[model samples]
Target: MEESEILRRGLDAFAELGYAATTMRELARRLEVSHNFINDRYGSKEKFWRAVVDFALLDVQSELDHRMAVGRDDGERLRNVIVQLYRLSAKASAMNRLMSDESTRDSSRLDYLHQRFIKPFWDSIEPTISSLIAAGRIPDAPTHIWYFAVTGPALALAQDPIADRLNPAASPMAEQDRNGMADALSSLVLQGLLPLSRGDATDRNG
Candidate 1:
């Protein structure tokens, strides 16, 4: 099978089983290949894991970059970036799961993922995020808090069972409803979450 297919499947396996539970042979089995295929090709589970991470992140980075480029101004760009990430988190559910799993520990896996993906992703958006901070439009919390607040709902759209149970609609949300939800969520981050910062500014000025 092609390497891309292996990487895609590996992403799902690692996200589901996590690093400690996943085995090279199990991955090969999932691929329907010889049990030792992964070990032979990647030399070890660690190398294969890195390859999978790199492959998934490359695609994410590309999409984010494109979204950033299309914006006409900083505010628009920042909003676009947030919207795109929300879509990606739901669309690339495995990546969201893997991020949540790795973030709970202090392992080299977290370090590797952070150094490779999280930090860089933050760096790209920091200037825009910071501008909002400077303008007193968002909370003055630590960077990591902002990261979590923005991404905490990554699984909300995918919890089909829970959403279906809670939602009163007879059918699933229409595309229009989904789009509206996305917009509302973005507004919550960009506007709703800023009351604290705005209050602080108000106190200082008045």
Candidate 2:
């Protein structure tokens, strides 16, 4: 009934069922609405899926934009962006799940995701990437490698079942734990990607 609730449930259903197997009727049932609600309101199932994506990703895009605007430098900006992304993924990983499934196949949905989210996201971070490359903090790598590097780390957040079994206390779903987890991930990722300074390397070597 409520638009946000509908979109959230739809996003989760699509992520769980996959695009083809998730019928509009099933979505309506999940949402506890009439089976034709999407057809009547959104025009079609494809359009409904698009709406769900648009709704679910808006906050993430906004967070990235806000984070990109404020960092002391490119490296700092990259770290801030990654940390914010981890926070968001911990908040809700449905979009990531949907993306993981869609990425394995070539479909219109995948194209839509690329055109709408993936390309824009990459473009948004191009300045940071360029600055890092120039500073030799990161390599001048291919787009796909950068893509996987940035996004792949967050995939584990989507696996609550495994996490609950393996380390219940460290579950990312817990809000109080998210900031520490994000910071830890940012440190781990940046340390591996970034070239250590002369003094830092010397300290480690010593």
* Each prediction's whole-model lDDT (CA): 0.76, 0.81
Whole-structure CA lDDT of model 2:
0.81
- Candidate 1 wrong stretches, greater than 4 Å: 155-161, 168-184, 194-206
The model with the greatest TM-score is 2
Q: TM-scores for all candidates?
A: 0.79, 0.86
Report per-prediction Cα RMSD to one decimal: 5.8, 3.8
Q: What would the TM-score be for candidate 1 when compared with the true structure?
A: 0.79
Over the full model, what C-alpha lDDT does candidate 1 score relative to the true structure? 0.76
Candidate 1 on 1-206: residue-level lDDT in tens? 88899899999999889998988678878888888787888888888888888987887877887898897666667778878887776666677778888889998889999999888788888887788788876668898888877667654544545666677473454333555566667667766654435654575488
Tell me the lDDT of model 1 at 38. Answer: 78
